[model samples]
Target: MTERPEPTFDPRALVRSLPQSPGVYRMIDASGTVIYVGKARNLRRRVGSYFTRQAHNAKTQAMLAQVADVQVALTHTEAEALILENNLIKELRPRFNVLLRDDKSYPYIYLSSHQRFPRLAFHRGSRKGPGRYFGPFPSASAVRETLNHLQKVFPVRQCRDSFFENRSRPCLQYQIERCTAPCVGYISEADYARDVRHVEMFLDGDSNRVIDELVERMEAAAAALKFEEAAGLRDRIAALRRIQERQYVAGARGDVDVIACVVRESMACVQVFVIRNGTNLGNRTYFPKAPPETNSDEILYAFIAGHYLGGNAPPELIVSDDMTDREVLEEALGGDAGHRVRIRSRVRGERRRWLELAMSNAEHALSARMSTQASMDRRFEDLQERLELEAMPERMECFDISHTQGEATVASCVVFNREGPLKSDYRRFNIEGIEAGDDYAAMRQALERRYLRVKKGEAPVPDLLLIDGGRGQLAQAEAVLGELQLTDELTIAAISKGPRRRPGEEVLHIAGREDEYRLPPDAPGLHLLQQIRDEAHRFAITGHRGRRGRRRQRSSLEEIPGLGPKRRQALLKQFGGLQGVQRAGVEDLARVHGINRALAERIYETLNG
Candidate 1:
């Protein structure tokens, strides 16, 4: 291969400007959009490597050739550089980098500590407040399912302290035996405190002990002729047993974290399984980036030091391998956690079994990623052959519109580069100018908004653009691109449903082509188009539904004057919906918190008068 030219920018000038320290560097276009991001030990040599002829791969050559500017942020050390790189790539989203697009925050189960009667809740995003958060669980439903099981196993309150205190009678949590209802005197403060202690024990990994105590209480209650309470306790105990059975039992290891690392083609994926008292609570995966030449030991060392720089800590961490400065790392982690951190290698026994489980998960994850990549490459090749393009449409973008009788119209733009779905690049638009039910106008609006960004150099102009419609939709999109003088800058096509809304039969339109083309029902190229079109449609529909849901939330009197969060919550507690609030009397309104006499009268007059 011919050597690519060095970037026209001054190398010495760049190095002189950069600190002889650790940090992340970005190669940017004249417009200041980051094309690639990297971390460096010797800021001079690492960056100089990019400008050298022999150092450039076809990909890096293309990336560097476009570099008109360089941006750098100095860090304290190489480990900090690694972390700063990951965070910047996540935020700036450079083009010529292998990115992890599904950056959605994981769900967690939180037992609120701020309230007198703390509730077990499903939470996501920041854990910036007072709570005992027990997970970075895989999904919201996963946390909810665990919360449901926890409620059954432990008779602790799941209502706010205010709601708990104001209750004249036991609520459904008490009726369902999930709560002791201390607010209504059904359970005493001391007894509720004991229940809270048991809950803490359960969360701390002493599930059997918690259940044993509950079982004993139930037996005693039955012996005292409290049959109803005893039966409820029996159900709870049974549920706890069921939950315990579901957990994977590892012999005699208490509250340990098993971590395994898998590195492939310079990308490292770390798998973590949280085990509490020998039972596997849950597992999560982290794909951390580092220097291309870095080894597993070096990567893990950085991962531990940088990952937990501000993150939560587990007392015992079981790893597949040991670190060089295990003592220093443990101490650093301990300082952050305010508890001694134990770092152990996977040895033969229960610890080894836990490590094996984590490795197995890492293997499965890598296998899935490889499969997705292979499928994507194959689909791209097939598209290239069909479209007769200069190259494979390595970066394909699909557009679709969604509406509910035109009431809540929305459009979605989804990107799939060489790897697979670039989820982070996926965007949603609220269709502003189109009339309800006008799909063509909606398509036009979406394309204009998308291409205008391209025109302004705000987004990468995709190699191909797939529209989810027929010739008419294709015409509107074509017109927009023409007006923007980018008609040939992007390859455009449309996929439309066939006669009678059939599954396989479909019509396709290409720019400047008068006749619609038909492909074999199972043609690979056609199937690829269908897949892209379907994904765009799914994305659009999901966005539309979310917007409609939020709109429904806003239209209620909950948004009316003087109805704050506390009062709105109280109204929801009494009345299920807006109609219920409307029908509620002045006295009922006054019963809600923060409503008071005047506010209640204002609400009553607004509704009834």
Candidate 2:
């Protein structure tokens, strides 16, 4: 079959033919790249307005300059249009769209009583469907710290249900009095339920009431001559007080998310402080990528829409920059959170204080970003001058080989530019079909695989390439690039470890240069090389370790019937490790969650066999 010629994009014609309904429009540039993505209540009017006599901002005008084609996908409603718009913006990451780039889910303290003895666990990702989620904590470490305090005060079982089920004796958590030993039936359901209630009250931000209740219990235990129990309660009371003291600042007595964005030149940072039930939980800063001169409210709207619609459970009050499109954003977000949402930029007293705090955080983050960028710019300039290149490399890639005495041999490529390490573009190649300990062969293989794609126009060609080795590795790299016909145009250099493995004294080897030269230890050009080379080394080592760990962990457990990822985690947590599971008796194995009698016997026989 003959391929048809590609269709030409006529923006005016496309807009002229567009249906005036709720929809999303994607503007494709001449290169067929989606340069801009947007949603509209009326597609025809919206797309037509771009070409009309309206004053388009510089950013909008720039986006339109390259737009050769317009594609519209109609939606049933404006809310659906908003949803499609968000999905497309995230999926395509168009150059002209404000992309929300949060790679981590908010942490929540999950508790469910249906497991007999509720387990207090720090959770992130999808809910368990029935359990109560106590947070959307700013960081995982915050959740971990809070969990530690809860384990001390509540003494509720914090182990996995499988681990809890398999326990024939109290674990270290119990030995340290951090758990009530309910796994071994040391605590009754009624008493454990009472402790669970205390946890609920504390998490619900009723620390004062919870502490008061604990005081009454401590006195009662003292009157009953149970000093050990009374002492435990006293410690719990102290822990509660400590938490209360740390969270003494009380303002808004409702669910509120204070959001503020600070834009510097071309960078913007959005700071979010989550205030729940009158207590300040914590704050997180998000740097949303947008044109530097982008309107604050436009950035805020995109940030909020991307976040709240992208799985965050929205709060009652969203305090941010004064968004003119507040109703559209709220309607879209409210549909997801199942609540009426309100946006406020102007507030009085405590709310204003919180908003100001958010703004300060945003400003601080943006300022730091500017400083780092300035420093990096200077360093890149220094590197450009030292390298004597045709032009300053827009993107630099450093390669390194890592392994432990030839085992798990791997090579890594790390990319960077003026902005710093482009982690998303980093690549790792697992060396194959090569003799162990042959660094030259390993490097050759990695280079061939990487540049072969560049030769085929399947990947971007970096302006500069740095390999982590002396003359021999540099020659190998040149040979690979020469085969791909890339050496003549591409700048390649090599760095070798100093004698005695000293860092600053390392040598730089280039193709035409005879004598290897060394840069002053503090030179910014050398500093840049050191950073890129170190990053490549680190990436290779980390990948090698992960490969080794995964290979080691895929043990005899994989042979067992019905033992999957979750069950394996449970067994490991219960028995401590693979070796622990191997040593466990069939009875002990049977006690693991979801591990019944027959399956336990099979696991034991399979491992022991």
Candidate 3:
């Protein structure tokens, strides 16, 4: 088979070429970047529907206006298309897609079964080694609490392999009865192996079975005239029972994830309860990013696809509402779990009680989220009144430049909207190709690089562009925006510090208006502008300081006569951290790919000094 050619620039030409089979399609903008990704059973029909979508929302219209090309990858089945679509969305992070903001892997309690004396460790990321994993736990603190309890109950090793191998005697853990002390041969391998088995069983949602085993052991130890060992076993069993009692929530019948979403004024908060073996481990909340006019069904569906399609799929999903593509989701999740994963909106008995609780949590969470959002909306309203804007500005971006003695200069742009800070859109630019002290040149470079994309439809233009300086900075930004021909009716304003440089006494210089504006010391609108301008200042300083620090912190590697940038970078990468480099012996330094004995000795001495 031959490789498929890249699609043409014309959207219609690309859409006409799509096969009728199921696949994933990526919408590319004029700048050759994916702006949206989607799955469809019939590629031709789905790709064609976008062009024919009547009464499209503002977001959809903006997306379609920039469409320069289309790309398709065929899959054998709709389920396959769904999987591919999810993978692409996570990898590419298209703008128009419903983005899962917090995608960090959940923590787990892990047992290393392959070692001679296996260690009980807390882990996250891929669950792929020869071991048993006990959780997709809600938080690291929860995992830590469980780990601490297990350490007391099972007495497995928790130290790293390096420290374990180098032990000269039993450590504090062994003294406190939280470890078996296999590091110094204080516990026989056979005895430690037995304890490890009990730990594994306890983590595998069979604490009752482990408790029974402990009871049997305690009785046997008592019968054998071993009072202390029997007492130890008794304590372990008690700890297990206490943990189980504390965690047990009776409403959930089996291992399931209860997902409930509450929507208010086009905003959604999805609260998830992680239930395992009829026990409620804990819960989490998420706010997926999507368009305002989008339906809750679509939001929930997209969230499910992004959150669980190919990751951790619980045996049962008790969802709050029925989705339009419910069957497709169930089929996809079922395939992912290698079982029939049920998605239920309606429940009875204990499951119903759990669902109701989850619904309450979702509503409460949404109310709190909306309350914070409403205050931000009021700030925007106040800003509209103060600036005399033609309409309420939905997106505002502010710029500030920072440097110390005109060195390591940097510029930052921070964005805000009705919901508050859009931190994902914040950007920092390193000032270059100009005099270090020239604020005008730095601002001009930042504005050109940022808005040239918007001019080419690579980015969305904010309703207002704020400059954190006097008229000179504003003039520089205005020159760039004018050069780019941004005819989208954007407002430009510059804020200068007061003559005495006081916060509330600052002046606002709006482009095309002769007079400057100010407000009372306690005005909410003035405070809002100060808040944004201060954020831009803080962001710029952080970037500038980071850059300057790296330069100042450059180690003795640069001082050595033979060590160049390449060799220094290699050494840093090999050791990974400053402390690691400092402690690395000559032998360890010599083992790196590039360094010989002479250079290694020099590096070791230099870092040690």
lDDT of 1 by residue, 234-328 (tens): 98788778877887574846667778887777767778787666666677666664445446676676566555544555788888777775775
RMSD of each: 21.3, 21.8, 23.0
356 in model 1: Cα distance from truth in Å?
3.0
- Candidate 3 regions with alpha-carbon error over 4 angstroms: 1-19, 30-32, 57-62, 65-69, 220-230, 251-253, 370-609
- lDDT against true structure, model 1: 0.73
Q: Which numbered prediction scores highest in TM-score against the true structure?
A: 2
Worst 10 residues of 2 by lDDT: 482-491
lDDT of each: 0.73, 0.82, 0.81
Off by over 4 Å in 2: 1-10, 102-104, 373-609
Q: Candidate 1 at residue 367, lDDT? A: 68
Give the CA lDDT, 0 to 100, for residue 548 in model 1.
92
Q: Write the per-residue lDDT of candidate 3 for residues 361-450, one digit (tens) a residue.
A: 988878876778656756776888888876567688999999998888999999987677889999999988889799999999999889
Q: Per-residue alpha-carbon lDDT of model 2 for 1-609, expressed as tens digits?
A: 999998776667787798989999999988889988999999999889999756988998888889888888999988888988988898899988888764546778999866678888767678867879988887554665677677768888766666678879886556556678888889899999999999999899888899889899899999999999899889889878887777655667777888898887888889988777777777776778897469888998888888888556445655667876677777888888888777888798977887888888888878876888767866876777776654456689999999888878889999997679999999999998999899999999999989875544346678789999999999999888864445644578999989988878989988877877788888888899999999999999999998777556566788677899899899999988787988899999999889999999999888788
